[model samples]
Target: MQTFTLNDGNKIPAIGFGTFQIPSDGSTYKAVSAALKLGYRHIDTAVAYFNEGEVGQAVRDSGIPRDEIWVTSKLWLQDYGEEPAKKAIDLSLKKLGLDYVDLYLIHQPYGDVPGAWRAMEAAKQAGKIKSIGVSNMTPKIWQQFVPQFDTLPSVNQVEFNPYFQQTALRQILAKNDVKLEAWAPLGQGNQDLFKEPILNGLAEKYNKNVGQIILRFENQEGIIVFPKSVHEARIKSNLDIFDFELTADEVAQIRTLDTGKGMHDPDAPGVGDMLLSGVRFDNVAQKDSQKSNR
Candidate 1:
């Protein structure tokens, strides 16, 4: 796998397997194990995902050495204060069954993010987390937070893809020496991304899938991507992107697809309220149960 150097001089795999929507129904274990078997060294999860234990169990059962795999988890919105953030890190470590996570992120910009960042820096000093970052933060948030911190974030994971190109945000991150990590790198398969004409042509020419073509483009753009797939064939295919490179013309062709929109906008009014309004552990449990029944 290709790798990028973080601001702290840590190397992160350019491509990873994301567990954002991994069903809580033991499927995360199977998916993670499959991803590891397919040569994915980076696994991105979060406490809010509610499947950290399963991901940890899968890593253990895979028989891969703990240090060989890179695990990333996030502190949730509710756990935003200094004390709460510190406690959240401990809980995340316990849930992940790891001594220290390779990468830890503040899940959102809401709540007491400045206090949480302070806690994150303290955790880094305490050797509890190797590196710390933020997710779903915009340029405005970073401008406010970055200046106040002695240590800048090593990464900023957000909803990036061909559609939401994030040009300005990327510039800010580059200026600060923070790497960009893409959560929905494939735009959640929106609007037939796999069937797009330009991508299809490139896929045929390169003998790869449209998804692989898209991933390859993003990789060349210097953005770290975590594309999730529970299907074995798809997972293997996603990892196959390392063997090819996209041409400049092909990259330009793909750039025309940007719509500058995110599926979820954290900056929108009432967005934070909407996210927490209907969320419940019981709802997660019921959703998991339904998936299992299916």
Candidate 2:
């Protein structure tokens, strides 16, 4: 697996397995175990996902040394204060059955983020987390946060795919030595993405799935992608990008698909307000509130 050098000099796998909507009925455990067996060393999960314990069990049962795998989790909005964030970190560590996590992120750019960053930075110094970052933050939020701290973010995980390219944000992050991690690299199964002519053409030329073509393109562009799939075939195929390389022309062809937007922008006007207002989970109450407010 190819690795990217973080701003702090740590190496992170360019590709990872994401467990966002993985079923909680033991399927998450099985999927994670299978993924590890299939040679995946990076795993992305979040406190909001409510499956950290299962993922931790799978990792422990796999008998793989904790150091060999890169485990990442996030601090939910409800736990954004300094004391609360510290407690949340302890809870996350306990859930993952580890003393430290490879990476810990501020799940969203909302809540008391400055307080959260203070706790996260403390965790880093105390060796409770190897690296610290923020997820779903825009360039503006990043610029605002970067200057307030001594430690820079090592990574910024966001919703990125062919359609939502994150061009300007990528440039700003690159300037600050932060790597971009894509959360929905396959666009959460958007039919239009699978139908793009350029992607389809590349799929045929490489004898790969459209998903594989899309992931390959993003990987070549230096974006760390965590494509989620419970199916073994799809997981295997997603990790098979190292075998073939896309040409410069092919990369350029796919670049035209960029819409210069994010499909899941946490920093959008109303969305930012909701996040900052302390909507912790994607439960019925939160869903209803978001709908009514919109």
Q: Which candidate is the best by lDDT?
A: 2
What is candidate 2's lDDT per residue for 1-294, written digit by digit as tens?
A: 799999999999999999999965688888999899999999999888877777787888898998899999998988888998998898788777778999999988875888999999999999999999999878888877668767888999898999998988999998888999999899999999899988998999999999999999999999999999999998888899999999999999999999887667666679767756754554532342233223
> Which runs in model 1 stand beyond 4 Å of their true positions?
275-294
Ten consecutive residues with minimal summed lDDT in candidate 1? 285-294
lDDT, model 2, position 154: 93
Q: What is the lDDT of residue 60 in candidate 2?
A: 84
- Listing every candidate in turn, what is its Cα RMSD in Å to the true structure after a full C-alpha superposition? 3.7, 5.5
Q: Which pairs of residues collide in model 1?
A: none
lDDT, model 1: 0.85
Task: Give candidate 2's error at residue 179 in angstroms.
Answer: 0.1
- What lDDT tens digits, residue by residue, belong to model 1 across residues 1-294? 789999899999999999998876688999999999989999999878888878888888889998889999988877788997898787777776678899999887876788999999999888899999999988877776678777889999999888889988999988878999998898898867767899899999999888898899999999999899899999998889988889899899999988888888777898767655535443453343344333
* Weakest ten-residue segment in model 2 by summed lDDT: 285-294
